[model samples]
Target: MLEIRQIPVLEDNYVYLVHEPVEKLTAVVDPAVTDEVMSAAASAGWTITHILNTHHHFDHVGGNEEIRDKTGCTIVGPRADRDRIPGIEIELGDGDLFQFGAATARVFDVPGHTKGHIAYWFEADKALFCGDTLFALGCGRMFEGTPGQFWPSLKKLRDLPDETRVFCAHEYTQANARFALSIDPDNVELTMRSKEIDALRAHGIPTVPSVLAAEKATNPFLRADQPEIAAQLGMEGRDPIDIFAEIRHRKDNF
Candidate 1:
């Protein structure tokens, strides 16, 4: 079995520690800051044996070298963009499996947030470590990929089991919820979720690790194909990618 813990740092970023107790193995996912990761591990009497990078973005891999240097942990990242990630010892591609102890996470090529972005899904544990590709109520901006490139990537994630717990890398839920409400005003589920997010953020609590089911219902990026969302965007019977592009453009300015 695997145990997952959230380590919030850098004002809004979240770094996760996926641990396998049977072998005392831990993988720190997207370590934005090394000190925060190390301090959390030390507090729990855990040693980071692996450093998992979801992308080559500075926030995601900023602490890669530091943590690896401090704990001698092996760095694993996307094979397609190995040249960008820091200290990549194992370069994985879509459909590749990364194993530690008895736990294995399947890698999915989820580009859009970044051209080489990837996500780790541990089906056995139902934990998804998606860096910046998929967020709570919104998706990442098309920084490196086009709208079409980003749309299919989101579908790959949306198709995951609804029960899967999505561990995203940022605390943008409140803002995302607000944006979702603007676009999906009649979505009761989203309305309620936005209230909950407001309360959580008001109290300085983390609003991450959102269930896939909840995201499917409330996240606008994932709902781009829905008739309701398309109608609101004045796009009926249009290609999903075009609707998705319009949503992204609105969000970019939102």
Candidate 2:
């Protein structure tokens, strides 16, 4: 079985640890800070063997070299982005399959959050390391890719099983849902979920690792075609892509 836990660091970043109990091996996704990651891994009694990166953002790969130096783990990421990242031992691309004991993760190139951002899908575990591609109630800011490129990138993730547990790189749900309600005011699902998230944040709980199906229902960015959303944003009858762009634009200021 794959045991997953979130290592919170640097304000809102999340570094996830994926472990295989039988082999006592562990892999981390997006180690934003080195000491926090090392401390958590030590506490868990697992040896870090792989460092998986979704993108080259400083906050995501900042710990790459230090962690690799300490653990001698393979640094895995996009083949095209080797220069941008440090200590890359396994450069991968779309459709690459990686194995860690009984667990396997399939790579999907999900650019737009960054041109080379990728998601790791472990089919058996129904888990996805989505980086900043898909969030609990929103998507990532487009840094290196256009809205056109970003749309298709998100569509790839939308095709995954609804039950898949989405592990995003940040804790942005509370704010994302607040913006979501500005567009989807009457979405009872969003209202209820936002309340739950508000409570979670109040208690210092992380509102992440949300189910894909729940996001599909409550996330405004994912509901680009909702009549209410379009109408509220004055995008009625406009191209769906335009509506998507407008929603992102509004959220940028929100």
Candidate 3:
């Protein structure tokens, strides 16, 4: 079985430590801080064998070399981002398969937040390390890619089983939920979820790895096609993609 833990770093970044005790192996995703990664590995009593970078963003790969220099772990990153990523010994691409323990991860090319951004899908375990592509109640801002690229990229994850556990890199659930509610205040799922997320934030708890089912039901970006969202946003009968773009634009200012 896979043991997963979230190591909070910086203000809102979440570095994931995934381990399989039976194999005594560990892998970390998006290490923003070396000390946090080291502490998590020590807590789990597993030697980290690999550091996975979803993109070349500094907040995601800032500690790559430091961690690798300290632990001698292999750095794996998107093959397309060789110039930007640090210490990448293994260059990965879409369709790449990597072993975590007894389980496997399939690489997904999810560009939008970054041109070379990728997500790791552990199908058997139903876990995803999606960087900034998909969030709990929102999607990442388009930084280096087009919305055309982003919508399809998100659709790829949306196509996954509803039970898949989505591990994103930030703690923006409460704000995202509020933005979602603006698009559909009558959505009971979003209404209830917003309160739950507020409580989680107040208690200093993590609001990540939300179930795909919950996101599908309440996330406005994922529900752009729903009549409730379109009507509430004064965009009745609009194309879903346009509605999605408008919502993202509004959130950028919000």
Candidate 4:
């Protein structure tokens, strides 16, 4: 079985540890801070064996080199972005399968936030480690790719099973929820979730690993194809990509 845990780090960033009990192997995903990841591993009683980076953003891979030096973990990431990732030994692209002990992760090229960004999907475990590409109730900003390119990238993720657990890189859900409500006011799921988020935050609980089904229901970015959202944005009958672009544009200002 696979075990996952969240490690809170710098500001609102989140790092995750994926563990395989059979082989006692542990992989750190997007370590924004080295100390936080090391402490998390120490607390979990698991020795780090791998560093899986989803993108080259500094906040995501800032601890790559230090973590590799401290634990000698094998670093893995997008083969196309070898130049950007630090200490990357296993450069992989979309469709490439990787193993950490008995667990396997399938890579998907999900560019938009960054041109070479990728996500790791552990199909059997129904978990997705999508760094900055997909968030709890929002998507990443288009830094290197166009909205057209981003829409297709999000489609690849939306096609995954709704039950898949989404592990994002940040605690942007509350803010994203507020922004989503502006355009998706009629969405009951979003409304209820916003309240839940408020409760979770008030109690200092982490809301990083949200279920994909919930995101599908509440995330405005994913609901671009919905006519209700289109009509709300004055985009009725427009192409889904155009609607999605407008949503993203609004988010940029939100």
Candidate 5:
């Protein structure tokens, strides 16, 4: 079994440490800072052996060099953004299989927040380490990719098993639930989820690693193709991508 630990850092970002206990091999996902990640690994008695980066964003790869230098870990990341990834030793693409001790992860090129962004899905573990691509109640903003490119990227993730646990890189669920309610006010699931999120946030609880089933049922971004959502946007019969773009536009300004 793979043991995963979440370490919150830099206001809202989350750094994950994935460990395979048999071999005691551990991989740190998107370490934004060095000290917290290093300390967490030390406290857990896990030695970091790999750095799995999802994109080239500074927040995601900021500690790559330091961590790798300290532990002599192999750095893996998207081949599309190789130039930007610090200490990238293994450049991976879509459909590529990456090995971490006894576990394996299927790499997905899910670009939207960034053109070279990727996600790691450990099928057996039912875990998806998606950095800034798919969030709990929303998707990442289209920073470098267009709606055309972004929608397909989301579709790939949307097709995953319902039981998959989404380990997104930020604590944005509370704010995302608010935006979801505005667009999908009538959805019973969304309403319930929004209230749940509010309660969780009120108590200072972390609301990440949401189930894929809940996200598909309640996230407005994932429901753009639903007729009800299109009707709510006053864009009945429009292309899903167009509806998605509109929702993203509204959220951008919200």
Candidate 6:
């Protein structure tokens, strides 16, 4: 079994420690800083052996060199952005399987927020480490990818099993929930979820590690193809991608 720990750092960013016990192998996913990641690993009695980065964003790969130098961990990242990834030793692309001990992650080149962004899906563990691609109730703003490239990227993730646990790298759920409720105000599920999220945040609890099933039902970005969502935006009968773009534009300004 892979033991996962969530380490909150740098404003709203989340750094994850994924440990495979039998081999005593642990991988840090998207470490924005080194101290928090190292501290978390020490607390769990695990040594960091690998650093898995999803993109070249400074916040995502800022600690790559520090962590690698400190632990001598191999750094793995998107093959498409090799030039940008610091200390990248293993370049992974779509359909590649990255093995960490007995746990293997199937890589998906899920770009849109960035041209070379990727997500890691560990099928056996039912866990997805998607950095800035998909979020609890929103998605990362399209900076380096076109709508054409972004929507399909989202679809790939939306098609995952409903039970998959989504470990996106931020704590933007509450704010994203507000935006979701604005356009999807009539959605009962979203309304209920917003309230639940409000309660969770009220107590200083993290709302991440959201289930794919819950996200599919409530995340407006994932439901951009649904007829009701299109209708709500007054773009009835438009192409799903067009509707998706409009929704994304609205959220960008929201």
Runs off by more than 4 Å, candidate 2:
none
For candidate 2, what is the TM-score?
0.96
Q: Give the winner by lDDT: 2 or 5.
A: 5
lDDT of 6 by residue, 1-254 (tens): 89999999999999999999989999999989999899999999999999999999999999999999999999999999999999999999999999888889999999899999999999999999999999999999999998889999999999999999999999999999999999899999999999999999999999999999999999988987899998899988898889889989999998
RMSD, one per candidate, in order: 0.8, 1.3, 1.3, 0.9, 0.7, 0.6
Q: Write the per-residue lDDT of candidate 1 for residues 151-237, one digit (tens) a residue.
A: 999999999999999999999999888888889999999999999999998999888889999999999899889999999989999
The TM-score that candidate 1 achieves is 0.98
User: What are the lDDT scores of the predictions, listed in order?
Assistant: 0.92, 0.89, 0.89, 0.92, 0.94, 0.95
Q: For model 1, what is the alpha-carbon lDDT of residue 222? A: 92
TM per candidate: 0.98, 0.96, 0.96, 0.98, 0.99, 0.99
| 1-254: candidate 3 lDDT, tens digit per residue | 78899998898999999887777778889998898789889987888888999999899999999999888999998987877899998888888998766889999899888999999999988999999999999999989987777888888889889999999999999989888877778888789999999999999988898999999999888877789888888999988778878888999998
Model 5: per-residue lDDT, tens digit, 182-252?
99888898899888989988998999989999999999888889999999999999999999999999999
Candidate 5, residue 22: CA error in Å? 2.0
Q: Residue 106 deviation, candidate 5, in Å?
A: 0.4
Model 4 has an lDDT value of: 0.92
Worst 10 residues of 2 by lDDT: 220-229
Which regions of candidate 5 deviate over 4 angstroms? none
Candidate 3 residue pairs in clash (backbone atoms < 3 Å): none
lDDT of 5 at 193: 86
Give the clashing residue pairs of candidate 2, or none: none
Model 4 segments beyond 4 Å from truth?
Answer: none
